[model samples]
Target chain A: MTTTTIHIPTLETERLILRAHTLADFDAIAGFYASDRSKFVGGPMSAELAWRNMSQEAGHWVLQGFGRWILEEKATGKTVGMVGLWYPAGFPERELGYDLYEGATGKGYATEAATAARAYAYDVLGWTTVISLIAKDNAASIAVATRMGAKADGTFPHERFGETIIMRHPSPEGLS
Target chain B: MSTLTVQQMLNSERLIMRAPQASDLQAYQAYCASPRSSFVGGPFDTAKAFEKFTAMAGHWIVRGFGRYVMLKDGIAIGHVGPLCMDESVAPEFTWTLWDGAYEGQGYATEAASTVWQHLTNDCQWKEMVIRIVPDNTKSCRIAERLGAILTDEAAPVWYPDSVTYRLYAGAA
Candidate 1:
């Protein structure tokens, strides 16, 4: 074995920052995965697995040039969630996914970080479009998508994650 | 970002210890997919297992040391290594299950010894501690076999009534 480094720019919003994941963020990620709320995004797992997920994020940066960034609250530097591009094996498109911690919701953190990430994807990464594979029954996330100007392309039956709504991103220039 | 360093494969008299692969997920999950897995917090669903599976691999990245998935004839059998789980429960020498058709073959002892040597010699872990649930006689026996002496320390906050066994790799 070899150790490889990944280059990811630290992105900031008014209230949040999209940062690379660290070992310290494992606890919060683990908590998120170990709860019923994790059902939509493959969660409610042991902490050990959560560690793997966070590692994947970092690894993704190295392998894919872009990955899910840990969403941090700028006021206190606490990890509140993760939002970024996710396109693993068998994934159809570069997905713009966001998952917030339990208490960090109802305040627009996901939208803020996701909006910034979308801009970064288009402006810096020069990607034309992104998609978020939202679980069909995940009303909360659908609302977040709508707020972010994402329109439902259609529903796709995912083998592992069940019925998923493919929410397509609007043109970056169109979003005011 | 914690980057996992791929440590070299280790060999024992009978077993090979290597970094886990994506294919080993099923075996690792099945090992803990039963009611008998309570000791290791098992009987979990596939999703959680996937997470747990990833967590073990990630542990290697975060802690600079973690157990290798023990193998016999290229088949994954067990996991043996050091893990730094949390601040309250940092750096543990753990020996876990040797799966189906391969159980009780003394693989645990061989694998543990090999890993102990690797950590003590290569990784420079001064001493290693094995955390055991008080009633986990199976693990207690393995800890004793590794020459780990029981220590009178209070249980780490994670699991109540846990006992600790200490091993000094320097002495060996």
Candidate 2:
């Protein structure tokens, strides 16, 4: 019985390193889910549920061939957020998502990380276009999407979070 | 950190236990929707079920090992293995039959026995634990047959109502 291992690709930006998640990231993940900032992303959940959520993100890569990555600051080697491609069940289409930890947002980390993720989706995975599902009230995220040249295409109603705005990014050709 | 890796597939006389895959999500979602899933926190909506399925696969990446789908004749019937969610705790050896059609066939015990050896012999795990709800007689019976001793330790804080059992590496 030979053993098998999985490899999650790492993406690099100018200042951030998007890499596979480790168990070591659980504490930082739990902290994000516990804070009010996580509200738009289906969070403010218990630490136990948070563990499951992180694992879900990691598994997404295996099941889908591409998933989210932990955003690490190259200078400090600190985990600042997560950004990547996502398309879970019930979702209308594939998405490019991003989330920044407390004290990490003002620096455009989400935009920077998300640009790399979107490029991977379009250039590497050959995806034509992608969308981001942002809570209706999340202006900061909306701003990030705007900066990425995404426009409000439609809405997706979530069971727990109410109506969400689906912002569509530029097509692969449009980006070039 | 030690790199923990488990065999992708384990073959028993009557079952093939393998790691969960992308193709297994549909069956898992169906299982979660059925009444059979009531015991293990199921009957989830499609969204939640998808989350659970991905999480199951991610557990392997996060902890270097996770549950395996019990494939009977190439169909995924259920999953069995040790799942360690938190680093501070022992991994729980869990087993489930996704559909009622697969129940009462003694498949759980067979697959479980094979998994036990893989974890103990191949993976070198010294201790294993299981948590079962008091009313889940079938799961309780499986625990007993595996030589897992009923322990005074409470279940994980998240599942307080359940009872805990422990099986040492050499005891089973």
Candidate 3:
């Protein structure tokens, strides 16, 4: 595996700014995961869990040449959430994933940021395929997957959640 | 609101879902030829099957939605889609694979159910649709298992050449 790091100072969308997660983002990131809202977004990620997740995301950039990005509000500079690519436990391939704070729901930020990441995966990283695994009951995520042009390949029994869907996207060269 | 990243869609599991490559074409072609490929018009010729596979992949870039080539042990077997079919009441559920060797295994159900959950719950799609050919007993069963309701309505004219079909409806 080639370990390449691309310093993305900031990735701008209509309403979001995708950047690297910094130590300064800890408190806000922790709060987002600690709230009850985290359950719906990502199911009760604790402060320690959030910190670990952030650190792991940062590690992905260094180790895999790509990783999840910290999402901030461009207008306010507030840390809203995090989204990006990383290997989920047990997955045979690299998967696409994301999360947002309670205050971030119902906005198009997920779609915008995810689309940018997909583009980066293909155009920058030269990936041919990307996958997104989502819980069965999480409708918000399904819509985002659809809007992003991902298709459901099937489902698998999850250790925590009963079952989850696996969605796929083709690279610029096209689908397999 | 924070922007969404591709990572949010993944959950920790034994297998990871990713895109298919050109090298997968031959294996995919063989999959389409398998007897269990019935759910997706099994027993297909390689040339035509490749055409269909490429078309589905194109939808990812053009429509922002398309099928994912399911992988296991580094081989392509089946596919699932957050598909949008106009013939029914709404865009609907879909899944298919080529290997009989992989059948009876819960892989299809696992992948489809995950995507469906994301679509209805996380994505907030209000209504979704799925249309199965009347003869495709396996697909019909799978759709029913997903809680898709069968409809009496006849399929539209634009549908690919197929016999009678049962429409299944679900929350968007």
Task: Judging by DockQ against the true structure, name the best candidate.
Answer: 2
| Each model's DockQ score | 0.13, 0.73, 0.01
C-alpha lDDT (0 to 100) for residue A141 of candidate 3:
85
Where model 1 places Cα greater than 4 Å from the true spot, the runs are A1-20, A24-67, A71-81, A85-95, A99-144, A147-149, A152-176, B1-8, B88-90, B134-136, B156-158
Model 1, A38-136: lDDT tens digits are 999876788865766776665455445677888989898888999998766457788999999989999999899999999988999998889999999
TM-score quality measure for candidate 2: 0.94
Record all residue pairs in model 2 with backbone atoms less than 3 Å apart, i.e. clashing. none
For candidate 2, the docking band is: medium
Residues B1-172, candidate 3: write the lDDT tens digits: 1112112222214333443334456777787777756655567766455545544543332233445556676566767765442223455456776677777777777766666665555555555556667677777777667776676666645445333333323532
Query: By TM-score, is 2 or 3 better?
Result: 2
| Weakest ten-residue segment in model 1 chain B by summed lDDT | B1-10
What lDDT score goes with residue B82 in model 2? 81
For model 2, how does the per-residue alpha-carbon lDDT over A1-176 read when each residue is reduced to its tens digit?
33335678898999999999998888889999999999998889999989999999999987888899999999998888999999998888999999999889899899999999999998899999899999999999999999999999999997766799999999998888
> Cα-based RMSD of the predictions, in order?
6.5, 2.0, 18.8
The candidate 2 chain A region of ten consecutive residues with least summed lDDT is A1-10
Query: Candidate 3 chain B: minimum summed lDDT over ten consecutive residues — where?
Result: B1-10
Instruction: List TM-scores for all candidates, in order.
Output: 0.64, 0.94, 0.47
Worst 10 residues of 3 chain A by lDDT: A1-10
True-vs-predicted CA distance for residue A111, candidate 3, Å? 0.2
lDDT of 1 by residue, B1-172 (tens): 1233325478888888876566566787787776656776568766566556555665554555566888788788888887765545436788777464676678887888888776666666667778888688877888888888898988766666689888886653
